[model samples]
Target: MNRKEANQPSPISRRLFFSYAGTSALTATLVLSGCKDDESGMPVDMGVDLGSGDIGVLNYAYALEQLEAAFYTQVIQTKYSGITAEEEQILTDLRDHEVAHRDFFKAALGSAAIANLEVDFSKVDFTNRTSVLSTAKTFEDLGVSAYNGAGQLLTDPNLLLIAGKIVSVEARHAAAIRSLINPKSADFSGDDVVDTNGLDGQMLPDKVLMLASPFVKTKINASNLPTP
Candidate 1:
């Protein structure tokens, strides 16, 4: 294959995709009830209500995965100027992983899944490496924190296990992006994100959504999510 062809992003295998989908289907069957505004008993007219309980948490994750998948897809499609082969390969892998994750959550939520979110990446400059990587770092960090914070809200052990697995992957992605931004440095697990107790930072849903709002055009109503 030519260099250009070799650098092209590869699709995730059907076997792997189906494996995740199957797991998601089982989880959905076990956890979800009908999608409804549990608090108001009426559909949310202002925006998407992320439901309540475990279903709400799953939808929240699905939303973030959608954003990440879309961002990396755009980056790969319109690669930044001066992107090296290594960078291209890294980004391609990230894109594939995020897409898999996004679809996995969608499959898990089934009928309870939130509608496809409309994103606004207008602030991101795809042509600039710094702009892309910086945004990537922000997203990866936020994803890790989001899962960590939401974990306590999940009552089901199976769901908690799944969330744990996904958060570990998100943490890895955050580290990779951090390394890219500050190669061969301790910034990969910087004190900013990792505290004195050596634990990764966690953010509640409200704070996470607020920070993520700029990139998502869909007004998310996360009011019904369980509190700590």
Candidate 2:
């Protein structure tokens, strides 16, 4: 190979990305399996109960990841009108990240994972860049807040560490979408999402699910999730 070719970084395939992304959480799953609470008794009359304790939190994160992955997949498949090549690449990367995250949680949760969520994106106009990007911002912001809010509820150190890592990625996604919406502006880390304390906003499980209801067809019962 030429010197330039030898210096190039290896391209990462989706399969390899999934394996890398899921390895830590998958290992945590094995460690947690022996000590996690039994979920069979969780109430499901209202809908799918996220379960309880750390499992519930994992399910919650998994559900949101599923929604994001589905949205980005659609965005890439349809490609909003006037989408630049750079925008296409960014959106494609976001789609892959979200899918990897979804698969990671699913693999981590194993039999404890929630069912695949059915999302309704009828409100999103794929032909319109404004509509597509605005919707992406909403989902991305919500995901960041969801992770932040749920972080305190995690009891296991390993799970909490994993959640922290995922939330940071979610924050990056949120910032990227915000920048796309308002380039050269401070909207990416605007005061609306970042408070006076310089910390990102957070929303509890119930509140997060309520805000996410419109996009999700499947009913989620976060009633069983742990509180403060």
Q: Local error of candidate 1 at 169, Å? A: 0.7
Q: All predictions: root-mean-square deviation over Cα?
A: 5.2, 7.3
Candidate 2 residue pairs in backbone clash: none
Candidate 1 residue-wise lDDT at 171:
92
Best by lDDT: 1
| Residue-wise C-alpha lDDT for candidate 2, range 28-95, written one tens digit per residue | 32121122234886543466667777778888998999999899889988998899988987888888
Worst 10 residues of 1 by lDDT: 1-10
Top candidate, metric TM-score: 1
Residue 95 deviation, candidate 2, in Å? 0.5
Model 1 Cα lDDT, one tens digit per residue, 125-178: 999999999999999999999999999988777778778888998998999999
